[model samples]
Target: MSAETDLIKLYSQRILALAADIPHLGHLDAPDGSARKRAPLCGSTVTVDLIIADGRISDFAQDVKACALGQAAAAVVGANIIGCTRDQVQTARDQLAAMLKQGGPDPHAPFDGLQVLGPARDYKNRHASILLSLEATLDAFDAATATSASSA
Candidate 1:
């Protein structure tokens, strides 16, 4: 098969995997606040709700709809950020973006679960779908933090 075909197949597989794991998809119910994000080009939207306690993420969930890439990306983000602090979430976001932009990184580190998206890097059009969840998650975290700060 051709490289394009291979990439498509990879994306398809990831999407299928996410679909099979339906319970993993959706948003956290954060008592603090919630945030939503979308990729206008692809119509992929993810809304994240999170609960923050003592400056750490106490609970998390998300509601997402879009292509396979977006769904899978959201699942990965939700799974990774559950117990993280705001700083840790920010760091993961930065590191994930950098890894996506600079090709693959050490698979054993911050980019572990996210590395599955490496094949997506070559497909410029799908990049937004892949990153949509991460962006949405960060936005949700920011909103949660802002709300917490104001309430304090």
Candidate 2:
């Protein structure tokens, strides 16, 4: 089968449905931190806003624009990030990058849902888009943590 066909298969109905049902898909008023990431490869963009409480993600939101891969990734992140810590998000991001670029194992625990995107590895152009949500989210977390630490 052609790469296009494989790409289509990679984005199964389950993924598409997840994309359509993304949680926290909007802006947050007076968020603790916010960040945006744009994939140069596919013009995919994801902006994240979040609030942290007791070093945990207390609330989160995102605005995403991209193909199904990006949407699905944002869905996974949004769905599971409610109580996540900066370490968890960073770890998930690192594991995802390894999985996509170096054939590493899937992400662990709360982010194991990202395993659904494993097939995306075969499509190099989609990697950045798939990682956009987590990238932006991690950035937001970093900013929030730094601000809190400095103020304390």
Candidate 3:
């Protein structure tokens, strides 16, 4: 097989693995909060529901629909961010964006299984889809925190 074909195969296999292992794939339900993000160009959407306690994420889930890249990215995000605090998630978001945009400060260690998406950085159009879940989760966290702060 050609190199392109090999890459495609690898990506497909990785996506499948992620889908299988993701804790919540279709509809994430959490008691504390929910947030949704959409990429109109690709019609990719992800809704993240989070339950935070004691300033740490106690539970999290996601509902996602998109292409293979989007779904895989969502799965990776959902799996990795479950126990993280809001600050950690924000750091991850910054690291991921940097990796995609500048190829700097590789967070591959924290990224864990998501290293498979390294190949996706080369595809500009796919970036939005891959980032959908992360963005939505961050937005949700921010909104939730703000609400909590105001209520307190």
TM-score winner = 2
Q: Candidate 2 lDDT (Cα, whole model)?
A: 0.92
lDDT of 2 at 28: 97
**Candidate 3 Cα outliers beyond 4 Å, as residue runs:** 1-10, 26-30
Model 1, global lDDT: 0.69
TM accuracy, model 3: 0.84
- Residue range 3-93, candidate 3, lDDT tens digits: 7985686477778777566666654444476788988788888888887888887878788887787777777777678778877777777
Q: In model 3, what are the clashing residue pairs, if there are any?
A: none
**What TM-score would every model get versus the actual structure?**
0.83, 0.94, 0.84
lDDT of 2 by residue, 94-149 (tens): 99999999999999989898888988888899999999999999899888878888
Ranking by TM-score: 2, 3, 1
Tens digit of per-residue lDDT, candidate 1, span 24-132: 4555443576778877787877777778777777777777786777677666766667677777766666766666677746334442677777766666666677777
CA shift of 126, model 3, Å: 0.4
Count of backbone collisions in candidate 2: 0
Model 3: how far residue 41 lies from native, Å: 1.7
Go through the candidates in order and give each one's C-alpha lDDT: 0.69, 0.92, 0.75
What is the TM-score (0 to 1) of candidate 2?
Answer: 0.94
